[model samples]
Target: MPATGFDNTIEVVAVVVVVVVVVVVVVVVVVVVAVGVDVHVVVALVVVIVAAVVVVIVVVVVVVVVVVVVPLVVVVEALVVSNGLWYYPHL
Candidate 1:
């Protein structure tokens, strides 16, 4: 079926709005994760985990000390410590 000009415009606008909303959501999530944990450690694991390490790697964030002790290695280098935080170990 042939679409009208008004329909096309609405479709384009809808696409644009969806794209913008997705971008904003991604940025907000990233910012929140970054601020909550250490960016460096998160980069290693590719996710935020309150910046903790295995065998008692405690990192102070804000006014709290987040301790990490990875018990299981789900992925190749991903470590899941306490407090539901996961991170990667240093080489």
Candidate 2:
């Protein structure tokens, strides 16, 4: 077996992130169930799930912005530059 370099690395990364998030969500659900249903615990689990989802969304958004926006900004800058048409926006 051999690995190939990803051309659309951001898409690949997003896919991986989605898979991981699904797995983690499932695991968290199972843990919540196994621990016995309690209102507080269920609430906590919901919060955890929501938080995980938010984090994943944020990660995907940031990656996408970097992948798509950065290049567009660069090209636009090359074509025509504003005061700050293209600059690395640090996280």
- Counting clashing residue pairs in each candidate, in order, gives 0, 0
Clashes of 1: 0
TM-score of each: 0.33, 0.57
Tens-digit lDDT track of model 1 for 1-91: 5442233544554565566556555755767677675665346444323222221121123112111222123232343344346553642
Location of the lowest summed lDDT over 10 successive residues in candidate 1? 54-63
- Candidate 2 per-residue lDDT, tens place, 43-87, comes to 777777788778788777877787788778767876654556456
Cα-based RMSD of candidate 2? 7.5
Candidate number with greatest lDDT: 2
Cα distance off (Å), candidate 2, residue 27: 4.5
Native-referenced Cα lDDT, model 2:
0.72
| Candidate with maximal TM-score | 2
